[model samples]
Target: MTAPRATKTRTPKIRENLPAPQTAEGLFFHYTPEEAAQWTPFSARTLRDRIAAREIEYVFNGRDNYLTGAQILSLNERYTVKPFSKTHTRVAA
Candidate 1:
């Protein structure tokens, strides 16, 4: 009689549907003073001063400061200059 052939057992594969990881562009609506300075025309020191003087809104997370998108929008509204009118010219009296 021939020896019985050994059978190999295979484990079933498991698949999971996990959420995609957040990227800097997607997750970072808030920014540090330094980061905000880099993204905008303001200097880091200027941002810090604004935070200190309460001219701008910020979040203090025990260790670091952060600025939100809404704050940035408000700042832009406050500081952004409108374009000069091309139709209106100064007439010498």
Candidate 2:
């Protein structure tokens, strides 16, 4: 005799207004390609290149690239590592 067939449980997909865990709250909650562009003052292409180089950290799945609010702040702060002006340097003659 064949055993009884097990029934598969059906689950409904629920859509919420909540953001994903990887995303940051407040500003970077949810962002699209256009929104990502605004995160940085740089142009879109520049941002894409930076993302590819990993100079700025990002969460990427498939063709989607995501960044948190903290990440944006981090990128802004990265420019603080600039070198001093030549005049500020003491040259050894």
Candidate 3:
């Protein structure tokens, strides 16, 4: 008799229901790399570099690259480091 294989399941990291950016003018569906960079702590060049590294998600509309608010948020979350308490002990691998 053969044993059944085990499968692993993972939940998605990013929330799909996240809304796009809402501006004073109106809700912008997407933001250009330059605009997206302004929203985050990084620069436009950094965003481009990240795109090249496939670290962040973006859209290419033929002429330029654009990013949705959710994607930018995901990028930020991916790099966000959680701080450990001073009393917390490190686990050795």
Query: Best lDDT goes to which candidate?
Result: 3
Residues 11-72 of candidate 1 have per-residue lDDT tens digits of: 43322332111343423366666656644458877998988898888878888677765566
For candidate 1, give the lDDT: 0.64
Q: Candidate order by lDDT, highest to lowest?
A: 3, 1, 2
Model 3 lDDT tens row, 16-77: 44344544321436776666665577988788798878777788788867787767777778
- Residue 12 Cα positional deviation in candidate 1, in Å, after optimal superposition: 49
Better of 1 and 3 by TM-score: 3
Error of 3 at 44 (Å): 0.6
Q: Residue 56 error for model 3, in Å?
A: 1.8
The candidate 2 region of ten consecutive residues with least summed lDDT is 12-21
Q: Point to the candidate with the largest TM-score.
A: 3
| Cα TM-score per model | 0.54, 0.49, 0.55
- lDDT: worst 10-residue window of model 1: 12-21
The per-model lDDT (C-alpha) reads 0.64, 0.61, 0.68
Q: What local lDDT score does residue 33 receive in model 3, on the 0 to 100 scale?
A: 66
In model 1, residue pairs whose N, Cα or C atoms come closer than 3 Å (at least 3 residues apart or on different chains), thus clashing, are none
Model 3, poorest ten-residue lDDT window? 11-20
